[model samples]
Target: MANSLVSIQILPKTKNGENVIPYVDEAINVIHQSGLTYQVNPLETTIEGELGQIFSIITEMNERMIEMGSSNVISQIKVLYQPSGITMAELTEKYR
Candidate 1:
């Protein structure tokens, strides 16, 4: 079971005022490549994994934005950590 649920909304400032959708797509790609369970929502992407691993992924996403020519990046993050364990499905089961 995962120990953390992290939802991040990355806003990357482009070099030439380019559209941000592509940059956002790339960030989501990074998360997808991580092979962790994730859900991509309209405003944010939520990931399920060990806390450390999730943070590492977040860092990589930021680095990717810079590498892709983002002048700066702002990440809005929300975390729910439980040492015992937690999963997105478990948490949203009632809604489903």
Candidate 2:
């Protein structure tokens, strides 16, 4: 079981005031390549994994945004860590 759940919303400033969707999609692609369990919501993406790995993924996302011509990147992150282990499904199961 994973020890952390991280939700991240990345806002990347476009260099030419272009649409940001492409940048966001690239950031999400970084997450997809990580092979970790994740859920993509409208405003943010939630990733479940070790805390360190999640943070590393966030770093990669930012780097990717910059590589994609973002002048600046803002990441809003929320973390839920349980050493005993937790999962998104476990947390939201009741609602489902």
Candidate 3:
């Protein structure tokens, strides 16, 4: 199966103190619970996995953040599927 790349940008209600970090942590926790491998970037998060799992995890994270008091959560995604697996084009085609 090809891996899809996920980029998620999370902004909390506040930029300073533990406010944002807590929400970030909560979001990360959602990713972890999703059973997918991911990396945290400076202003974004990257997750690589199956298309379904990737989308599911991102949605879960966004919902979790909202439950944590985040008014707005934005997500961007890119999947790099290999020919042997599912290709990015295929994933997009399926979703689109």
User: Tens digits of per-residue lDDT for model 3 on 1-96?
Assistant: 545666677665643334588888888888877766677778877776777777777778878877876677766555565435644345458676
Ranked by lDDT, top first: 1, 2, 3
Q: Give me the displacement of residue 42 in model 2, in angstroms.
A: 0.7
Task: Quote model 3's TM-score.
Answer: 0.67
The reply for model 1, stretches above 4 Å from the true place, is none
Looking at model 2, report the run of 10 residues with the lowest lDDT sum. Answer: 63-72
User: What are the per-residue Cα lDDT tens digits for candidate 1 across 1-96?
Assistant: 999999999999997789999999999999999999999999999999999999999999999999999989999999999999999999999999
- Writing each residue's lDDT as its tens digit, candidate 2 over 43-63 gives 999999999999999999999
Which one wins on lDDT? 1
Distance from true location, Cα of 78 in model 1, Å: 0.2
Q: Supply every candidate's count of residue pairs whose N, Cα or C atoms clash at under 3 angstroms.
A: 0, 0, 0
The superposed Cα distance between candidate 1 and the true structure at residue 46, in angstroms, equals 0.1
Each candidate's TM vs. the true structure? 0.98, 0.98, 0.67
Q: Output the lDDT of residue 53, model 1.
A: 99
